[model samples]
Target: MVYDKVIEIIKEEFDVDEVNENTLLREDLGTDSIGLLELVMAIEEEFDIEIEDANLDDIKTVKDVVDSIEKIKG
Candidate 1:
């Protein structure tokens, strides 16, 4: 559920048609620093959860985002 929502958010935010768990936020998705920040904002809004600034550095892929959400929601 979270993964699906995250994928949807990524697609809408980055305007990309293809994405998966392994897709890198920067390389595979072409997300610049600003885009990444925007994506994080969108994710925070979508999931209604707060992601720490410190944890942002650890998020490099789709799965990482999903894991972050799950960990925070826990």
Candidate 2:
């Protein structure tokens, strides 16, 4: 599922020790713009789904990314 994939991407990209639904992208993971872009690209490649620019601004947390990916998949 997208949730699991997102978690995997976050863990791998940030080299985090752990990840949860509440883990924030900027705060907890310290991801900058380039990192965010990389994460988005990874998500797109992994899920075979494209995320729109408009929705990018609204994503601030790991849960948000998971939700957005699920919505796009749906």
Candidate 3:
């Protein structure tokens, strides 16, 4: 599943042990602004797709990211 790979990437990028669909960036992971940008870069490289910078503001949880990847893949 895409989420499986996404979770792995997120775990590695955020230095977290685990991440689920509901995991929130700020509340659950304590991700800062720079970290958020890094996460976007990692996602782009992993999936080989470019995401609009404005859309980054809409991303809040792990599920949002997975959805974005799926949408882009589709």
Cα lDDT tens digits, model 1, 1-74, are: 99999999999998899999999999998888889899999999988999988888899999999999999999
Off by over 4 Å in 1: none
**lDDT score for residue 8 of model 2:** 91
Arrange candidates, best lDDT first: 1, 3, 2
Candidate 3, residue 68: CA error in Å?
0.5
TM-score of each: 0.96, 0.93, 0.93
Clashing pairs in 2: none
If both were scored by lDDT, which would come out higher, candidate 2 or candidate 3?
A: 3
The sequence of per-residue lDDT tens digits that candidate 3 reaches over residues 1-74 is 88999899989987899789999987899998888889989989989998888898889999999999999999
Best by lDDT: 1
- Candidate 1 clash total? 0
What C-alpha lDDT does candidate 2 achieve relative to the native structure? Answer: 0.88
For residues 1-74, write the lDDT of model 2, one tens digit per residue: 77788899889989997999999888888988889999999889988999987787888988999999888878
Which has the better TM-score: candidate 2, or candidate 3?
A: 3
Give lDDT for model 1.
0.93
